[model samples]
Target: METQSMLVVPVGEETEFNVYVSTQWPTLIQEAVAETLDIQSSRVTCHVKRLGGAFGGKVIKTSILASITSVAAWKTNRAVRCVLERGEDMLITGGRHPVLGKYKVGFMTDGRIVAADFHYYANAGCFVDESVLISEKILLHLDNAYNIPNLRGFSVACRTNLPSNTAFRGFGVPQGVLVVENMINDVAMALGCPADQIREINMYTGPSVTHYKFEFSPDNLQRCWEECKLKSEYGIRREAVDQFNQHNRWKKRGISIIPIKYGIAFAEGFLNQAAALVHIYKDGSVLVSHGGTEMGQGIHTKMQQIASRELHIPTTKIYISETSTNTVPNTCPSAASFGTDANGMAVKNACEILYQRLEPIRLKNPTGSWESWVKEAFFEKISLSSTGFYRGHDLYMDWDKMKGQPYSYFTFGVCCSEVELDCLTGDYRTVRTDIVVDIGRSLNPSVDIGQIEGAFTQGLGLYTLEELKYSPTGLLYTRGPSQYKIPAVCDMPLQFNVYLLSDSNNPHAIYSSKGIGEPTLFLGSSIFFAIKDAVAAARSDSGLMGPFTFDSPATPERACLACSSPFIQKIPASQPGSFTAWALDI
Candidate 1:
C-alpha cells in the first residue's frame, strides 16, 4: 500500500485579524472645538472629515477600526497603521445582507390595507449582528403609513460562510424595506395598477394615529405623490418609455413608484441615548461636545445650528469637539440618522442650562462691563451638563405586553423612477428619479439634499451595479477602488427631483427637524424595481415576476445572468462552499 502524503489542517488558529472597521462614535469633534476657539461662528465653519465612502462603512464599523488601531498603536509604542488591503477589507467588512422576503398583502379594491403577512429571511454572515435590528425596522414600517387592522410580520436569521455584516445607509431598514416594497410592485402589476395610483389608495394617507406614545404626524403622502409626479414628469416619462420600448423590440423599459415610511431614533429606545457638555468661557465663546460622529453628513454643522437656536447666540460663538470617550462617554453609534436628533438635543439642552444661569447676570448688567458679567455667571453657575435619550414614551406602549406605538414618529415619502436597459449586453441606466420626502424641516437644506442624493446614489450602486467576490477559504477577492465599482459622475440620472415638506417639523424630533440619512438609501430600491421591470419586459416573462428576486451590488455580469442568459449552470449548493461564481470556472 502506497502511503499518501499526510495533509495537515490548522485548528483553532485565529488568523491575524487583518480587519478595517468604521464607527459613528465621535460626536464632540476636535476640529469643531479648535474652530470655536478661533473665530467661532462668524465664518460658520465645521471641522469635518470622513475615513471612507458609502454606508455601514461610516457607521458602527469604525468602532472596530478604532479598537484595532488603538491596540496596534499601544503595542508598537509608535504610530502603527493597520490598513488592510482590498481583499482583506472585503473579507472583514460587513455589507448589505442579501435578503429573501415573502409577503401576502391584502387590500380592499379601494386601496386600504386590511390584512398582511410579511416573512423575512436575512442572511446574517457568520453572526447575528444587525439582522434582528433590521427586522425590527421592517416591522415598524410595515403597512408604511396605512392603518392596517391585522398584520403579522416575522424575520429569521440564517448563518452563511461570509463576513459578519453590519449597518449600511438605512441601518437595517433597506434590506427589510426592499422585500416589502418589491411585494407592493408585484401586487400592483398583478392587479394592473399604476404605481402612483396604488400609493394614493393604500399608504398612510389618512389621518395619523400614533402607534406608540410618540407623536404621529399626518403628513400628506397623497399631496407628495402629486407634486412629485408632475415635477418629475412621471406620466410623460412613462409614456416615452413605452414608446421607446415599442420601437426597440430587442430591449424594454419599466418604471415604479415606491413609498418608504422609515421611523426615527434607534430600533432599541435605549440606543436613542445621548450626552453632551457645553462650556461658556469668560470671552462668551461656547464649547460643545456630544456623542455623534461626523462623516461628511453635516452632523457637526447641524449641532451648531441646534446650539445656536437654544443659546440664542450667533452660530459663531460655538465650537464642537472630537467624538472621544473622554468628552462624551459610552456614546451610541451614529448610524440611525439620529446624530443631530440625539446629540444635538443634548448640546442644545446643555447650552440652555448654561444660558439660564447667565440670564440673570446678563439682564442685571445690561450696561455693566462684559468682564464683570462673565465673573458673576461662571462662579455662581452649577456644573454645565445636559443629556437626552429617546427612550420610548410609556403613554404609548404596554411595556409588559409589547403592544402599542413603538416609533417616536414616522418619516414618510415615495420615490418614482424611470430606467432603460440594453438587450445586447444586459446593461441598464437610471434615466431619472423623483423623490418626495417629508423631512419636517431642514435646518440646512443644502446638507439634507446632499445626504439624500449621496445615499440614494450609493444604494443605486448596491442594488444595480456593485458586486463583492469571495474565495472558498472565506476570503473576499474584491477590495479597494481598483477592484470595487461605485457610481461615477457620468452615471447620474438625466432627471432628478427632490421635494421636502416645507411647513412641517418632526414633533418628536429635536426642534422638529427630522432625519434624512438612512431613508435616502432605501429609495434606491425603487429604482431597482424599475430596472427589474425593464428587464422583465425585455425578457417578456410573466412567471419570473413572482419569486426570482435578485440580491444587489448587481455588477454587469450578475445583471446579465439575472436579467437575461439564465445559463443552466449547476452550482454545488452546500455549506462550507466558496460563494464565488467566477472562481467556479477556474
Candidate 2:
C-alpha cells in the first residue's frame, strides 16, 4: 500500500505519510497498487517502452501494470518505478493450462485420414482469461494440413483456484497438432508404413472446404513438405537413421515430417479488425501506425515494408512507431500472427488512399519521381493523411453464423524432426529439424527467415521441453527461471534447415507475403510425434499406442513415466482428485 494515497491536502495543514512501492503488472500479479495513492486516473499518463522476447506472456496484465505506474506518478508528482521480479511475475500470472486430451482418427488403409474426433479438457487456472479461446482454437485446428471428411471436437472448461492459464507462442495450435500427429503415427506403425508414405497419402492437394465452411488451398502444406524433403534428402537421411538405429542400442533414432496449416486470425470474432494510419510528410518521409504489438516479432519492420510498397517509396524513407491505441484508435491486439497480414493489410489500404490523393497531382505535373509525386500529393490533398482498416476478406458473412473466411488467408509450414532417444533414461535430443514455409512472397527474405527460425524454436520449447507445474492447492509452484525451464541454446538440433516457398508477387498481401508467426509454432507436436515413434520403437515391435498423451514439454521425467509401466495409473494429471475419483470406482 502506498502511503501518499490521500484525496486532498489543506493549505494550512501539513500532510506526511510513507509511500510503499507498487508492483508491476502482467508480470504475474494481476492488479497494481499506485506508486502514490493520491494519484487520480484523470491526471495520469502511461508510458511504454519497447517489448523484448515476451514469448506471448504480456497481454491484459501489462495494461494494469502501466496504470499503476501512471497513478504513482500522478500522486507523488514523481516517476515511480516498479520492476517485477521473476518469482512474483510467475506466481501472480497464469501459465499454460495442463490439458487432458483424447484423440481418435480413422483413415484409409493407404493412410488418408477419413475422420477425426478430439476431446480436450483444460484446467483453466484460476480465471477464465484465455483458456476457452485456446480450447476453441484447438478444436478448429484438428486437421492441421490434411483433409478429413468428417471431424468432431468438443471441450470442457474446468475452473481451478490457481492463476489462470494464458496464451503462449503456439497458442492452442500446438496442442491440436500434436494430438492428430500422434494419431497418424499410431496408424503408420500399425500399417507398417514409413512416415513419408503416410504423409504423401494425407497431404493436401486441391481447394478444401473445411468443416467451418471456408474454401482454402492446402497445396502449400504439401509444397512445404516436398520442398523441404528434397533439400534435406529426407529419404536418404531416414534410411541412414534406421540403419544406424539398428546398430545402436543406447542411442536410437527416429525421423518424421510434419505439416502445419494454421488459421491466421483471432478465433474470437471481435478481435478480427486492425487499424492503421499512414501519413506522407512534406520532406518525402512517411509515417505509418498499425495495431500490432511488437514484442520483438518485427511487426514494425514489416509495417514499414508494407507502407513503402503501397506508396511506391523506399522502405528506408518510411518510419513506424510503437503500437498505441491513442494513435491508432480501436486497434486489435497483436496476438494473431496477422501482425503483418491484418495490420499490414490496413497500412497498405491507408497508403492506397494517400496514393490516390497524390495521383492527380502526379498526373498533372508528370513527375516520374515517387518522392516528387508524394510531395505534390501532400500539398494538394491537405496534408496527405489516411486511415485504413482490415476487416477480413472481401466476403460478407454473419459473425454469429461462424461461416465466413475468418482469416484473410492461411500460412503453411512443414517441420521434419529427427529425434534420438535413450530408452533407458527417456531423454531425447532433436538430431535434425527441417522446415519450409510458404510466406507467399518474401518482402524481406532475411526477416521472414528469422521469423520462421524463432517461431519453430519456440514451438520446440513448448513440445520438447517447456511447461508449467503447480501444486494441489491451486497455487502455482513453477515460479521464476529455475523451476520454469525453457529450451537453452545447446538444446537446439545438430542439423537445422529452412526453406521459404515464396514467389515475391503474392496476389494476397502487400508483397504477397503471408503471416509466419503461429504457423511455425504448431510443429511442436509434430516433432513430438517423431520422438514418440522413437520411444515406441524401443518398447514394442507390435504397434504404436492408441495415443501418446499430451506429453508436451515431454521432459525426461514425464517421457520416462509415459514409456515405463506404472501402478495401473488411471488419474488425469490436469485434474485434482482425478486419481481419487478413479480409486472410488475401483
Candidate 3:
C-alpha cells in the first residue's frame, strides 16, 4: 500500500481513433471494423496509412472506435470520423495496469534469493481485455533474470470502474520485474552489500528452470552483467558515490545496475503467427505486405531489409505495403516485441519462395541483370507472387498446467544508472546511464538503439515522473498533459551510452536477430533502484541501519520523508502490518 498514495497514472500518448470504411479484408482499417459492426467483411474497406504512435494502445481500441464510426456512417449515410480530445482520450482509453503486489522472499547472507512467494493484483478496469494474459506474463516473469529455486506466484485481475487497462511496451513484465527488484534491493540492504553483488550471485548463467518449468540454455545474462559492470565502471563509481554521500548532507548520489532476460513471444501462444505477401515485377522491384502493423518501431524497415537480403536485391528496390487483413488474413497484433521476428520471418519465407522460382532461370543465364532475370522468369510463366504463412514452430503452453515454452527465445540486457537525489526537495536527476544489450546480430543498429533509448526513457517516466490520479468517485484527475508529467529532453541522462552485444546471434530467428523493443524498457528499473540507493544513503547518514522501503515515483515528498529521522521516529515500531516498520526490521 506504500505506492497507493503515489497515485502514479500511466502517461501514454493520446492516440486518436481514425478509420475509413470502404468496400473490403485486404485493406488496413475495414476488416476489423466490418466484423465488429456485423457487416459483410468484404463490403468493408479499411485504410490505415500509418499510426501517430500506438505503443500497444491502438490494437483493440482502434477496432472499437472504428466499429462505432462504421455504425454512424451507415445510419447517417455519410462519412463519420470520431476523434477524442486529449482529455476525452485520457478518460476513455486504458493505460498500463495499476498493480498491487505483496511478496515475501527468503535470501541468504550473501544475498541469494532461495525462495519467494508473491501475489499481484492488477486493476483490470471494467473489463477483462488483456488483464488475464497480463497476469500470466507477470507470474512468468516474477523471477526477472534470476534463478530462484522455490518460487510461487499468481495474479488477480480485479474488475474496477475505470477504463480497461491495455498493453504498454513491456506488457505487464515491468510491474512484475519491479517487485522482484525491490525484493533484491531489500536483501542487499539487509546484507550490507551492493545490490549488484546480489544480482550477479543469483543470475541465470547455467542450466536453470523458471517457476513455470521452462528451462534456460546458457545465455548472455552473466555476459551482460559483467560487460555493463566494466563498461559503466561500477566499482569505481560506487566508491565515488560513497565519497560523495560522505561529503554531502542534503544531496546524495546512488548507482545501480539491473539486468533483464525478457522472453520473446505472445503469451497466448495462438497469436504467434504471421503472413506476408511478396510480389516481384519484371522491373525487379518488389512489394511486401505483412500482417504486422508498423507503429513507429521500424518494423517495416526491418522487413524491407529482410526481403532485400533474402532475395539478394537492393533495399531501395523493396517497398513495404500498409498492413491490411485483405493482404494477410487472421493477423496478430504488432506486440510482444515480436513485430520483426514474426513478420520478418514471413517476409523472408516469401522472398525465399520467389528465389526458388527464379533459381532455374538464373542458372540458365548466369550473368543476367536482376531485371532481365525477372523478365525471363515471367517469360517462363513462373509465379512472380507468393504468400507465406509462418507459425512459430515450437511454441506450446498448457495454461492450466502453466508449463511450456511461451517464448521462442529470450532477450537479454543490462542497465546501469547514476542519479543524484536532493533530500530537501525529493528531486532527482539522472547523471548518466550506460547500457549494454544483447540484440543478437542487430538487423539495424541505429533503429534498435533508438528503440532502446525511447523505451528506456518511457519506462523512466513510468517509475519516476508520471503519476496518474483519480478522484474518490472514480473520475480521472490527471487527464491532460498539464496535470500528467512525462519526462522531457531535460530529464534525459546528462551522459548516455548504449551498446549492442556483438558475437551473439539468435539461432531461431530470421537473420539471427533478437527482439530489441521491450527488453530494454525493463532496464529502467535501474533508475528506480538508484533512487532507492540515494534514499538509503540519506537514511544511513541519519544512523538508521536497516532496509528502507519507499514507493515509486519516489516523489520529492517521499524522498524527504525517507531521509527524515523525525519521520522514522514518528512511525510506531509496534504498528502491525506496517511495511515501513517491517522493512526496518528485515
Candidate 4:
C-alpha cells in the first residue's frame, strides 16, 4: 500500500479547477469536485499521471480526497493538497467484503454436482457503495468453470454500522468461486476421493452454457486443466504427498489444483466503453491519450503497441502522455480487467483513421519512407488528428429475468499448489507451485507473467495470510501493518513455474488477447485447499473422519484448531455451578 495524494488549484477567468491526482477515475473526481463546490462540471479538469498502487481502492475512495481538496482551494482561492498516511488510509478505508456463505449441495457417487442451493450474505458496512454490483457479480460467477446442472443462488449485501466495503482486485468473483470449491472439497472428503477428481468430473467440457446463458464451445479451460496436470506431474506429486503423510507424524504435506474461467467486463453495461484521442505531428511522431489510467499494469505500453501496429510505425515513435478528463471525457474506471480490452481498441480505431487518410499519399510514392509520406500528406492538407470510441456489443443483463450476456468474454487458467505444514504449531510453507494460463497470444509476455505472479501473491495474502480483527464494539484492531498480516518475501513458494498455453486465440479483444488481470487471482485458493488437505491428514491420524467445515483466511490459530486431536477432545468441561462461561466458543 502507498499514500494516496491529490492537489487542487483554482485558476482561470471562469474560476476553473485544475486537479492533479493519482486516480483510476478522473472523470468521477471532476464530477464530485464540481458538485461539492456547486459549479459546472466543465469547470473542473482532472490530470492523472499515475497511481503508485490502487488495485481497486481508488476507484471510489479517491473522490473523497479530491472533493475535500477542491473545496479548500475554492474557499481560500489558493492551491490545496490532500494526502493520506498509510495508517490513516487503513483506518478509514474498507477492505474486501466479509462474506457469510450458507450452502447445500447434492452430488452423485462419482462426484458430479447435481444441484446446489446457496445464500450468500455480504457485509456492506455503514453505507451502500457499489455493494449491489458486487452482489450481482457473486451470483454471476456462482459456477466457476464447473457444470452444475441445477443451480439456484441469491446474494445480498447486508447493511452494517462500519466503514463501507469497496471493490477489490477480483471484485466478488473469488469469494463466490470459493463457495463451490469448498463444497467440492467436502464432497470429496465424504466419498473418500480426490478433490481434483470431483473438479474434473464436474468441469464444463465441449459445449456448455452458463446459468446466465453465456455459451462456450471448445472452451480452453479444459485444455488449461489437462496441460497444468501434465506439467505439474500431478499424479506423481499426489503419491508423494501420500507417502510423506504416511511417514511423518508431526509434519504433513498436501497438494491441490484449481481451475479458473473468469468473465472479462464490467457488470454495468454502460461502463464497458472507452474513448481515445490520437494526434500525429507533422514530424511523423504520434501522441495517444486514452480513457485508461496507468497503475503499473502496462496499459500505456499496450496502447503504444496497438497504435504502432495500426499506424505501421515503430513503437519508439509513439508516446502516451497521461489520462486526462480534458481529452477523454466521462470514462469508466480503469477496472474489471478491461482496461486493455476497451482502451486498446479505441486507440487502434483512431490510428486506423489516420492511416487511411495517409494511404493515398503512401501509394503516390510506393517506395517512400514514412516521414516522406507524412510530409506529402501534410502538404495535401489531410487531418492528422482523430477521436475514437468503442463500446461492448451484445452485452446486457436483466436481473428481473435472470438472463442476457453480461460479459464480453471469458479468460481461463489453472494452478497447482503444494504446501508442507507443521501440525504441532500450524506453521506452513509453500513447497512448489505450477500455473498455466490462456492469455491468447500475449501482447507482452514479460508484463503478463508479472501480472499473473503479482495477482497470485495478492490472492495468497487474501486467502491465507491477511486477517481482519474487530473488537466487540466494532472498532478495527488490525488497522496497520504491525497488527495486520500480509504475504511477505518468506511466504513465497520455493519453486515456482508459470507457462502460457499456446494456440489459444481470443477474437473479441484487440490483437486476439484476453484480459489476464483477474483470472489467475482465484487460483490462489489452491493454497487454502492444500492447507485443508494437510489438516485432513492430521485428523485421519487421530481417527477423525468424514467431512468438516473450514473458513477462509486459514490463519495459524484456525489451522492448529482444525487439526483436531485426542488431546483436544479430552479437555474437561467446566463445573455446573462454575463461574460465568467464556463468551467465545474458543
Candidate 5:
C-alpha cells in the first residue's frame, strides 16, 4: 500500500488562499502557501481530509509541493493540482537516511557493556532537509533499552549527490539502535556467551540515569524482557534451535530476542506542542478538531475516544472533523511518536472544558440524558466552543552538555523471534515471533497492537528485505514497487503473537497512555540477528569460528555469502575479461 505525493490548491479572490492536500501538518502547508503567494497567514487555509499512508514522508515534503502548486493557482486564478507518479515520487522524495555507524565497546565476560566510543555518518543526500534532527535522534537513542556507563558518540551528516532523505517511521533511531545491537551481538559472541545474557546484563532496571542525563525512574524494559522470555519459551526454543542446527547439515534454525526503550518526544522542544478545538451542539453531538493529522495510524480514532471518555458520552456522539489550519494553527508535524501524547492531551483538555461547562446544568437535572443537559446548557447561554492548547513542560536539552529530559517518557518492548535458514540459497522463514510491549494503559488495545505490528514489519523490511539501488549519476534504479520490496503478507512470521504489558500505567500524557509509533520498530531487527545466528551455525560446520560482521537488508546475496562453506569457496571469481564495474552497486 502506497500513497503518492499530491497537492491541490484553489485560489479565491486576490489573497484568499485555500489548499486541499494529503499531509500530516496542514499549518506547515498553509504557511508555505501563504509565503508562495506573498500573503498573510490568516488569508491562507489548508484543509486535510486525511492521508492514505504517510510515515513522516509528507510532513516536510508536502509543504514544498503545496507551495509549488499554490504559485500556479495564484498566478492563473484557478485551482491547480500537482500529483507525482509512483516513479516520480520515489525518485524525487527520498526515504530513510543510509547511516554508517562505527563503534568500539568494552565489556566483561558476563556480557555487560562497560564503555563505548562511537561515530555515525549519515548519507544526507543533496540537500539537508531533516538530517540534523535525524542525527540528533540517532545519538539520543544509541542506548536502546540498555545502560551504557561510559559513552562518547558523535554524528556527521555527509552531503551526497542524491535525493534528500527525509523522515521514515523510526526516524534515525532505528539505525543507531541497530549499531548498538550489532555491537552487543559481537561482544556476546566474542565472550562465547548467549546474546540474550549480554542484553539482560546491560538492560536498564530500577531508577537510573541515562547517558544523556535523563532520569529513568520507572524502567519497564526488564519487565517486558522477562515477559517476552516467558511467553516465547525462549529457553526451550534455544535448546531446540541448537539441536536442529546440530542434526541438520544444509538447513539450520536460530532464535534471538531484542529489547527496546524508545523515547516519546521530538528532539526539538518547540515541536512537542499541540492544540485542539471542540464544539458541543445542543443535540449532544460533539465535533472535535485537533492539530494531529490522521495518516492511518488511528490518531483520529484515539482522539475521538479520548473526547468521548472525557465528555461521558459514547464514541458515536463524538466526530473528528477534517484537520484544517483555520481551526487549529501552528501544529507540529505528527512524527516522533509524540502525536498521541501531545494531541490526545489537547483533545482531552478541550473536552474537559466542555465537561466543566455542562456540569452545572447536569447537576440541576441529575437524571437527565446527555442531550437534555446539552440543551439546558445551550438555553443557559453558556459557551459551546473552546480551544485547548498544550505545550510540553520541563523538556529541555543542551547540545554542549547533552543533559536534560528530552523525552516525556520512554516506551519499552521486547521481541523473541525464531527463524529457519537455508544456507544454500540464503533463504529464511520466520517460524514464530512473540512480542511484549509496555504501552502504558492503552487507549485502544487494537490500535496499539496494529501499530506495533505495522511498525515491526516496516522495520523488518529495513533490516532484512528492502534494498534501494541507485545509479552513479544519483538516479534511483528501484523507483517502484516492482524493484523495491516492502514487506507483504507473505513476509510476515508464520506464528505471530503480540502482547501488551499488564498492570502498567504511565503518569505522563492522557489516561496514562504512552506513544506506540516507533518503540516496536527496532525489535524487528531480531530477525536479522537470528539469521546471523543461523549463518554462524553454518560457518561452524565449515570449522569457522569467531565474530563475523554483515551489513543490513540482509538480502539473499549477503546472507548466502555470510554462510561460508566449502562449496561457496570452490566457486571461482568471475573472470573480468578486462572489464571493470562502471557504476556504484550499492
Candidate 6:
C-alpha cells in the first residue's frame, strides 16, 4: 500500500501559499500548485519537513492535495489546512496495482526455462496516472533473476472505477517477478527437485542478455545464493525438515531459497538527473541542499557525508537544508533507489567547486586555521556558494523499441526461508530466514540493512497477510488497519540472519554503492515458496502427485485447499459457508 498522510496550509491572503506536503516530488507539487492557483511558479512554496513513509504514493497524489488546498484558500480569502484521516486517506489514495497475469513457460527436464510468454493486465483503476509506466516496468522485470533464451511479454493497463493504482516500492516489478517465480516453483515441482536448484540452473551468467537486450557482466547473483546457502545451512535444514515431516503427520516443515536481480534507475531516462547547492559560511560551516527527499531512508545523511568527504571537512561542519525547489530547481523525485547515487554526485560536484575556490587561500596560509582561510576567501569576494548538477550519462532506452540499457546497474540478493505448517489448521510460522544482499560497497551499512529489513517485512506482508479487499460497487473494504492485516512483530522469523556481500561494488554509482531500497522485497517471495513447499509435503503425504498450484497470500483457507487431495470431498453447496470447519476432515 503506497499511501501517505499529508498536511497542507496556505500562507496568507496572498496568492502564495506555504504548502506542507509529504512527498518525494515536492517540486512537481510546487509547480502544480502554482499552475492551479494562476500564480507564478515562484509564488508556490512547498516545504517538506519529512515524510513518515511514502513507498511511492506521495509523489503525484500530493500535488492533488496542494491544488485543492490552494483553491480553498483562494475561495475563503484565508489560510486553509487539510489533513485527511486514515480512512479517508486510504479511500482516496491508490496502492499497488492488483495484476492478473497469464504465463506459459517451456522448460527442460533439468529445470531450465527454454522460453516464456507472459501477458499481464494491471488494474489501473479510474485514472491513468503512472499505470502505463508501471506496466512497462512489469514487462521489464518478467524475467526476474533468471535468463531465458526465448521470452515474450506484454502488459495492459486495465481501467476500473476504483481509485487509480500508483507506484509502490518496487513499482510493478514485484508483480512480474511473482509470476515468474511462481512458474519456476511449478517447474521445480514437476522435476521433483528443490526450486533453488532450478533457480541456480537458470541463473544468468557471463555474456548473458536480458529480455530487453541489456548485457550483463559478472554479478553477485550466484555469489549471494552460495553465501546464503552456506549461512542458512540449507541442505542440513532440508534434511531436518524432511525428517520432521515424515514423523509428524499433522505438522510439516519446509524450506526454500530464492534469488533476485533488480535493475536500478528510472526506466524513463530523463529522470536520471539531480542538482545540489552548497554554501560555505565564513565560519567554515557548510549548508547543503539536494533534490532528494528524506523519507527515513537516510538520503540526507548520505548527501551530507558526500559533501563532507569531498570538501575535506568534518561531517559535523555540514548541515543539510530542507528539500526546496527554490534551492534546487527542476529536480527529479527521490525514487528508484537512486536518491543517494544521483544527489550524492551533485553534492560532490558542488563541494569540489568550493574546494577549488579555497585551494588558493589554503596554499597562501597553509598553517592557518580553517576558519581563517574561509574568512580570507570570504574577504576576497570568492563565491562561497555553488550549484551542482549531474545527469546520468550513457543511460539510454527506446520505449518504442523497448530495447537498450534502462538501468545503470543491478542489485542482487538471495534469501532462504524455513517454515512450519499445521496440516489440519493450515496455520504456518516462519521458523528461520537467511539473507545475503549485494549492496555494492554500501554507503551506510546500518541504513542499507534497515532498508533491506523494512522492505523484506513489507513484501512479506504483501504476500502473506496484506490482503486488500473491495466491495462489489468499487468501494474498498480494507480501508483501515482493523480490516487489513499487516505483518506484526510476531510475524518476523524466529531465527533471522542478514548479511551484506562485502566484496561487491557497483562501478557506475556514487561511492560504488548500489540501490538497496526495493531489491530485498523480492527476497520475501522466499517465504511464499517455503509455504508452498509445506503444502507439497502435505500433498505427498496424502499420496498426491504432480505439481501443486494455489493463489497468492496462502491464507489458511487457501493452504488447506492446497493440502487436500482431489478425492477428499469439500463441504456441499448447502454448507459452503462452513468449508473451513469441514476442511479439517481431510
lDDT of each: 0.64, 0.66, 0.79, 0.89, 0.87, 0.84
Candidates sorted by TM-score, best first:
5, 4, 6, 3, 2, 1
lDDT of 4 by residue, 139-187 (tens): 9989988899999999999998778888889998888889889988999
- Stretches of candidate 2 off by over 4 Å are 1-49, 67-78, 267-270, 360-381, 394-404, 504-506, 541-550, 560-586
Model 4 lDDT, residue 403, Cα: 83
Cα error, residue 173 of model 2, in Å, equals 1.1
* All candidates in order of lDDT, best leading: 4, 5, 6, 3, 2, 1
Between candidates 3 and 6, the TM-score winner: 6
**C-alpha TM-score for every candidate:** 0.80, 0.82, 0.91, 0.97, 0.97, 0.95
Q: Compared with the true structure, what per-residue lDDT tens digits does model 6 show for residues 1-586?
A: 3345444455555666777778899889888988887888887777777788888888788788868877887777666767777788888877898888888989998888999999999999899989998898888888888889899999999998888888889988887898889889888888898787898899888777888888886467878988999999999999999999889877888898988888899877789899999998988999998899999999988887898789887899999869887888888998998889889889989999999989999999999887888999989999999999888755677867868898988898899999998887788899999999999898889988999999999888877777777765667778788988889998899998999997886889998899989889978888888888898998998888777667777777778778884434465344666544411210
What lDDT does model 5 reach?
0.87
Model 5 clash pairs are none
Better of 3 and 4 by TM-score: 4
**Each prediction's Cα RMSD?**
9.8, 6.7, 6.8, 2.2, 1.6, 3.2
Q: Lowest lDDT 10-mer window, candidate 4? A: 577-586
lDDT-best of 3 and 4 = 4
> For this target, which candidate reaches the highest lDDT against the unseen true structure?
4
Please provide the root mean square deviation of candidate 3 (C-alpha atoms, Å).
6.8
Instruction: List, residue by residue over 1-586, the lDDT tens digit for candidate 1.
Output: 0110111111122312222223444422222222323422222112223334435554444445545454553345444445555555666667776667788888776655577798877777888767666666666666565566677777777788778876666756777767666666666666666655656666664566533333354555666667677777788888887788778755667787777777766646666777887776777677777767666788888888888888777888778756545556656777667777777777766777766766788897877664566677767764444443333223233545546655556676778888777755667777888898878777899999898888788778777767666665756666666777778886777888788866775667777778888777878877788877776665554235433555554455555666643331233335654553553211
